[model samples]
Target: MKISNETKIGVLTAFAITIMILGFNFLKGKTLFGTSHTMYAKYTNVQGLATSNPVMINGLQVGTVYSITTDKNMKEILVNMTLTKDVNIPVNSYATIKNNPLGTTTVEIRLGDAMQYLPKDDTIRTETSAGILDAAVQEIRPVLGQVKNAVKSLDSVLMTVNSVVDPNAKNNIRGILENLNKTTAGLTESSASLNTLLNTQTGALAKSLNNVSSFTGNLANNNDKLTAVMTNLDKTTTNLSNLDLQKTLTTLDATVTELKASLGKLNTTNGTAGMLLNDPKLYNNLAATANKINVLLDDIKTNPKRYISFSVFGKKNKSEPLKYPLPDTLNAPYIILQK
Candidate 1:
């Protein structure tokens, strides 16, 4: 068959249009020969979800996001996913947009285990998750706020320090450094002298240390005696502990209580001791009796015949004072007064 140029151009134009359509559908992840179903989901935010983005189920690519549209109120976004017919979406399946760490977004349809499958063009559940950067920003917000506050505090402290610093601070610091250098030099000299002194005394110091070590060795050798002494101390302490100290304390307390009670009784006016202590009349009577005895003694001394009589050869003798027979117990010349 002989074809004309007009027919050839017409065929070429049609072929080109078909190839463009196929290429467009291929780019949109659509299989021209495969059967697919449309599923709908409503989302509040798409989070950079776009058409031609791969829809995955169990990490397998089964569909692509077909279109995104807003509802009448523009409050919710309607997302249409064109999934292959072989991919069965359950009634309660959910479509979620996931973000990768590489800063790319993907749609994932999580298949549920419901026996009922969703009809074509039916709206499934939708959920939105924050992107990696979004989540990172969210987590870092408080830390950044704290860092900002710390920065402000540091700035204020630095301002205060700057204000408090003298204009001659540099000169003062230099002077201080110079003084420090001098001090360091003096310390170096002192250290050298001390090192020399230490060198001179090293032998004596070593000898003293050796003596101390020998003393310690001797002590260590007598450890058995020390142990025995400690054992004796323990036994003494045990014996002291075993004594009835509590009973002794109780007895002492009782004695003290009785003594206090006796003292209290002695202070009362009814007791003999109290009468001796507190009675003025008894004291006066005792004084008067002593005075009368003194007068009697004086009278007896002046008139010997009034108190004494002597008989010599059956006749009365008044020249000498009479003497009564004394008991054997009364050997002394002094009179013994009994109460």
Candidate 2:
């Protein structure tokens, strides 16, 4: 058998392409020959993830990322996932990329509830994301700044305390003790004066304490009386309950209704109170009376002696003044005379 060089190159290329395709399918967590259904998820960033990436659950191969494409609107990277036909996903299922704390990263889909079945070829929404480590690294700056300021404040406080508590600047102990003794003597005298005050008010304090004790004793002694009153109240309530409560309530309702009707009648134009309330003639009479009173007050203001007369018989006037006849409208209770 004689093979040409051109045929050998073509065979090698075809074998290489087969191996590459199989390797890609294996990396995507799929059997190279198995059938899969498609789903889609969008990520803010692809995070070095690419086509043919394996989608796994609990380290088991389930599916593969079929393709990764940037949105034409330039918002997100959309990932098309081709999962095994048997992998049932709930509608609430989500896909997330997980990196090993120390190793290569991969994508995983979390099946929401095993109880509920997911139909094939369902698109899962990526509503939440586990943020990148870069975001947390950005926060270290402000925290470090605060730590620096706290250290500076501590240093300033130490400096102030050092000046205040200098060994050479500390005052003499005996002088301080002497002043303290004088203060204690004054306090003792004040305490003695306060004790004397208590002695002076002792009888009143004792009487007040006795009154409090008597009140407490009365409360203690009347507990049975209070209990008996409560018992009587309960008996009265039971007796009232034994009466025709429904009929009594009905009567009360009727009486209240009648009272309301009577009150309404009082306010209506037909009744006497109603006439007084609604009548224009009554208001006109009131206005006339007010005007007359205003005029009388004005007259008294002009000539005080005519309306208000003061006479001192013993010391000044030496004669009784004539008493004016009291008017029915001006029947006030009392009139006080001033010296």
Candidate 3:
């Protein structure tokens, strides 16, 4: 074998190419030199994501970013990653960036939620999230502005609050509080007399209530006796109503029967009440006797001298009228007729 110079140059060029390919694959934690399945990812910004950055699936580096370029037409950076064919990433997995603290570049590619088996050499959906430092810087911008505004306004608020807490003003407030306390003390003193008067009235009210209780107890005791009397009266009235002895109807029926029997006995002609009750001939005789008595009384009323005769032999009429006139005064006459 003749070691020629041209052959040596050709061999070194091939060796350098082999070394570059191995280095690219070694950076992705894959075999040094093998056929890497090509896959692509798109990111919003790939400022520091280099071609040699390792692509890790679940914290295991399995690939490297093989190429990175911003497409002028799409206005998004294209990140083409060379992944080991043995490494499977789920289609729904996410890609996030990792960078150093200086925030100058990102070189770490991490896969998240990579459980599903993706296609060989498939272009997975890309996402670009800022590193913690960059997010912190972005977040701090608004917060720092608020701090600057607060610092600018603090002096005026301090000045306003200082006036309220001043020692002289506190002393004046203390004096006003002490005067109000003295006025409250005077009112408390005045209320002591009112409290005493209320105590006296309370004592009198207790005595009056005691007297009323005694009177009410007496009334209650007497009410029991009164109730007993009323009960007895009601019992007496009920017994009298139910006995039937006091009813005049019973006696009246018996008296009516007995009187009917007596009337039956007396109804004969010789009976005393039967004459008035049934005798028409006796009524006629009584009527005739009444007629004689009426005639006699009428004759007495007409001429009283018919029942008597005047005897005046000692006194002679010395003078007489031409016509003999009846005496104005009827003289007592001797009885000549006897009934």
Candidate 4:
């Protein structure tokens, strides 16, 4: 059968329109053949939720967001979710709008513990979760403030450095660097000298080291003698430590007290030694007696016949006793006058 072109054109246009309607409904999350139930949720803000977004139950996609609308008061947004007929949501179940990291939003349904289920078209509770971008902004806020403070601190430090580095300070720094260079050169020379002094063949340090080594060797060889000497020293110290120092001190103190008493008696002229020391008359009499004895000896030497006339040939010379002390010319210089 040959159809007319006008009829064919009309049929094709109608089929295309029908296909577009079906596709539009599908895109809007309307089930074409399968059965679904509509559930409602109200929120102050839908958080960018839109129709055709997936509706999830425990991370499983069970439905889609059917529509979003505002109430008559326009203070709240009402969301419609079309869930599969098989999904039995309990009473008091809630829905939350979730934003994915990839910038997509979904409606998540939470089941309640009540045995009774919510009827279709009933409005469930709604909540909004913080998106990744919002959370990131929240976390970075303090860090941004800290970065800003660090920048300010850096700027302040730079200003301080600029203020401190003046022309005089620069010259002083240069001078210090020059002095440090001189010191470094001097240290290098000293190091070389030290190396020379440490030479093993010809250096005094080597000779000193050799001497020390020899001394140590001698000490090692005399180790037994040293030990004996040390033992003797220990015995001497022990004997000294064992002496009765307290008894000696007590005896010495008694002797000192006796000596002090004797000295006190001597100073008081109460004893014979004290009288001899303190009486001037007695001292003068003794001096006189000694002078008389000395004069008699001088007279005897001058006239030997006065002492003995035993020799018959010798003249009988009568010598009177010397009334005063005769100054012996040989011994006169040895006399000491008593004041």
Candidate 5:
């Protein structure tokens, strides 16, 4: 029998549809030809878990997630997994969802050591694990904040330093340092000159000091003689002080009193001395007699042959006559001319 073209197309289409169905089931990890153990787990969050995500045990692919749905209460997510019949799990095992470095999600079944096996439809305990990126981000978060604070503090310190330091202050400091250097140099030069001057004067200064010392030593050595001289002077002063200066002064006073009394009596014209002082006529007679005697003596000096003759030859020498000077008419006091 020959088949129609429509029938042949229908049969090919049916076969293609069957192949697509099997392929879809294979991709969903459903073993249509074999049997598997189904298990359940509940979680608050799924973290992008989906059907057909692989389930593993010890890095071995043992099953896949079969379905995920909300529970009847709508409060928790419920996950159903289809495990291989050969992979038996303990009753106390956990189902943990984990994210990989590639950002894909998977479920890992951690087996427990209990002798009793988990029933096929029982719920497993659920957990979640952090990815590499998440753990790294968590570790670096605090350190990033601290580094930001340190950078801000360093910027503030730089601003303070910029405000405090100025060009004028730097110039003033430089000038001060220059002056100090000049002063130090002057002091160094002067120190050498002073040392030279001291060296030159050292011997003279020492000799002068030695002379002073010797003078003082001489004074010290003559201290006893000085004491003796002072003692003699003290004794002379004491003896002079003990002398009767009052008695001598009294004798002098008595003699002066007697002389004054005699002077008074003579001035009164009561004695010969008084008569001589008071009598003007006697004084005139004495004055006339003195004038006569003076004239006679003068005549004798001029004409000696008239007054005396030499008898040796009984001859007289002729000479000029002696003339007497007339006495002055004014009365003057008697003043004797002494030879």
Candidate 6:
């Protein structure tokens, strides 16, 4: 039988609607023709969990979140999950809403070892997991606080520096840098001069080094002479060391003492020499006797006949005895004239 165009259009539209609804439900993890179980969980916070989010069991999606609602007092969030898979969930199993940092939120079911299974529409234990962002924030919170404190300390230090560094201080610092540069320049000049002074061909240091080398060569050539000299010096030192210096010094000390005693006697009137040295009257008398003897010798030399009469003809010539000494006729005289 041929249908009307309107009726055919209506049938197509109905089929399209049915297909769309099935797709929508399938995308929501709902099984319209297959068996599915619903479970409920209560939480103080859902952590941005929404409907149609996957429910995972060991990384496998077994269900989806059906709906989310608040309790009568609105003190807690109640979430219903529809399980699409036939896997048994223990009565002691717990469900957690996992909030991801870079992805969608979900419900994860952790199974317990209980033999008994949870029935449909039953309440499951609920827990909330810390999101990656939340955990990172928790880890970084203390570090952020420390960074803030460090920034404050740095700001305070900068303020202190700003207060301490003035225009005059800046000038002084510049002057110090200038002086340091001058010192560096002087050091460079000194280094250049030192290099010049150490030149191998022409420098004073080189000349001195050559001289020293020559001296060392001469010493090397005279090694035997040096050794002989050193031996002689050693023998001399040995002889000196072997000498009885103490006995010599004792004898010298005794001689010096005797000489000192003799000198002391001479300084006093204890001996003839001392009387001659110390008594003026005896000294004057000796002087007079020496003068008279000198005059008699002079008179005898001048008048020989008065002292010795010797004649073959018995000549007796009379000459007045020299009461006073005649003037020395000869320039040569042995006695010192006393006036």
Q: Give the alpha carbon lDDT tens digit for every residue of 1-339 in model 4.
A: 999999999999999999999898888878889887888888887777889999989989988888889968889888888886577888878898887757679988888898988877787877666777888999999999999999999999999988989999889999999999999999999999998899998888999999999999999999999999999999999999999999999999999999999999888777799998898989889777777677777777777778878887877786576666565533342366799
Which regions of candidate 6 deviate over 4 angstroms? Answer: 1-188, 267-285, 294-316, 327-339
lDDT per residue (tens digit) for residues 1-339 in model 1:
999999999999999999999989767766788788788888888888898888888888888888889968879898888886476678878888997756556888888889998887788888777777889999999999999999999999999988988869967988999999999999999988777655645655566777899999999999999999999999999999999999999999999999999888778777899888878889888766655555555556656556675744454435543243234212233355898
TM-score, predicted candidate 3 vs. hidden true structure: 0.37
> In candidate 1, which residue pairs get closer than 3 Å at backbone N, Cα or C atoms, i.e. clash?
none
Preferred candidate (lDDT higher): 1 or 3 = 1
Per-candidate clashes, comma-separated: 0, 0, 3, 0, 0, 0
Sorting all predicted structures by lDDT, with the top scorer first, yields 6, 4, 5, 1, 2, 3
lDDT by residue for model 5 over 1-339, one digit each (tens)?
Answer: 999999999999999999999888778877878987788988887878899999988888898888899957878998988886577788878888887757568898899988888877889887766666778888999999999999999999999977987999878889999999999999999988777555635755566777899999999999999999999999999999999999999999999999999999989778899999998988888878776666666667666777897787866767655455335422333465899
Q: What's the lDDT for residue 54 in model 2?
A: 76
Q: Once model 2 is optimally superposed onto the true structure by TM-score, how far is the C-alpha of residue 39 displaced, in angstroms?
A: 2.3
- The 0-to-1 C-alpha lDDT of every candidate, in the order given, reads 0.80, 0.73, 0.69, 0.85, 0.82, 0.89
Question: Which wins on TM-score, candidate 1 or candidate 4?
Answer: 1
| Per-residue lDDT over 1-339 for candidate 2, one digit per residue giving the tens place of the 0 to 100 score | 999999999999999999998887677655667776777888887667777777776678677788888857868888888777566677777788875556555677777874776566666866444445755666776888899999999999999987787555555555688899999999999988777656635655566777899999998999999899999999999998799989988999999999999889878888888888878899888766665665565455555665456765523323333333235434332333798
Residues 231-275 of candidate 6 have per-residue lDDT tens digits of 999999999999999999999999999999999999999989999
Residue 21 Cα positional deviation in candidate 4, in Å, after optimal superposition: 19
Shift in Å, residue 220, candidate 1: 41
Question: Can you give the TM-score per candidate against the true fold?
Answer: 0.39, 0.36, 0.37, 0.39, 0.38, 0.40
Better of 1 and 2 by TM-score: 1
Best by lDDT: 6
Clashing residue pairs in candidate 5 are none
